[model samples]
Target: MTGGRSPRRAVAAADRTRQPTEVRRRLIVEAAVPLIAERGSSSVGVRDVAGAAGVSVGTVTYHFGSVQEILSEAMVLQIERYYAALSETADRATSAAGALRLLVDALFTEDTDRHWRMWFEYWNAGEHHLDPAFAGGQDRRYESWHRQIRALAERGVADGEFTCADLDGFTTRFAALADGLALQRLRQAPPLTTQDARRHLHRFIETELGPGPHGVGLGPAE
Candidate 1:
C-alpha cells in the first residue's frame, strides 16, 4: 500500500509468477514417464513424481488427480509422440514399400531405442494398474496402423505397384507382422538389425507385386 506491499508480498508475487502452470505440469509428466518407466508403479506415487519434478505433491494431484489418472495421461501423451514419429516416418519414405521399411526402421531404429522401450516399460510393467481408458488406446493404435496399411495397399494396387489377393487380410497381416517384427527386434537384436528387416520387407513386397511402380507415401527415418 505504501510503495509496493512488503518484502514478503514481493516474494509472494514472484512465486505467483512461476512458469505457466501447464508448461510446468507437462515437464513434470515428461520427467515422470522415464522415472515411472524405470521404477515400478508401486514404488512411485504423487509425492515421488512431484519430488522428481521439483513441484509440491499438491500441484501434481491438482493437475493429475490420482495416480491412475496420472499414469493414464502419461501413457496417452507418450503414445501420441510415438505415433506422431511413425507418421513422420511414413511421410519421409520414397514409396509405399520404402515407407513400410522406413516405418519398421523408425519404430526400432534408435540406438538407445528409448521410445519403444518406454512403451513396453510402461505397458508390460504397469498394465495391471493402467486406466481402463488405456485399452481403447490399443484399439486406436491398431486402427491408426490399419489405416496406414489400407492407404498403402490401395495406392500400391491402383498404381500397379503391389498386388494382393485380399486387401483386408493383407493389410491386417502387414500391420500384425510389422508390430511383431518391431517387438521381436526390441526383444532380440544384434542378429536382426533395422537394415536386415527392411531388406526382408523389400523381398516380401517384390514377391507380392513383382515390384516396379512404387506408391508415393515413402518417408525418411523418423
Candidate 2:
C-alpha cells in the first residue's frame, strides 16, 4: 500500500501499546511535578503536562478528571519523593542526633530546592482559591512531617542524646521554625540564604535541645 512506517515509528507505537495505564498515569504525574515546580501550579496546564510526559493531551485527560486532579497527584508524588529522600539520608546516620543533623542539612540545600518550590506552588494555589483538590491531604502531609521530627526527638530523649523537657512543645516549635525559615529562604525575604536558613535551624535546635550528645547540631553553616 503506502510507504511502510519507519522502524523508529513502529517501535514507538509498540512501546506506547506496551505501557500500562498505571505506568502512563505515573509518567504524567512525574512530568507534572517538574513543570509545576519550574512554572508553578497555576502556570502549568494539561497541555504542558502532556508534552512533558510525551503523551497525548487526551491521555492525560482520560487519566485525570481535571487539571486540579493532575496537580494534586503531582504534589502527592513530590511529597512522597521528598520524604523518601530525606529519610534515606537520615537513615545513613548512626544516632538520632546524627539523623536530625542530616535531615536539617538536607532540607535547605539545592538538592531539595525544587521540592520546596513545588510544595509552595501547590500550597499557594490552594490557599488563594480554596480549591478542594489542592487542599486535600495537606493536613495529613504536615502531620507526617511533624511525626518524623517528633519521632527523632523521642528517640534522642530515650537514648540520652537529648534532654527535652517538653517533647510535644519542642516538636511543634521545631517544625514550625523550619517551615518559616524555608519559606523566607525560598522567597528570598530579606535576601535569606541557604546557609542562613540552616544556621537558624541549627541554633533553634540547640536552644530547644541544648548542646549535648543528644543535641548534635551542625554547629554553624560553613
State candidate 2's TM-score: 0.85
- Check candidate 2 and list the clashing pairs: 161-214
Give the candidate number with the greatest lDDT: 2
lDDT tens per residue, model 1, 101-144: 66655655654355555566556644575556567666676588
TM-score of each: 0.71, 0.85
lDDT of 1 at 118: 56
Output the lDDT of residue 85, model 2.
88
Worst 10 residues of 1 by lDDT: 1-10
Separately for all candidates shown, the number of backbone clashes (residues 3 or more apart, or on different chains) is 7, 1
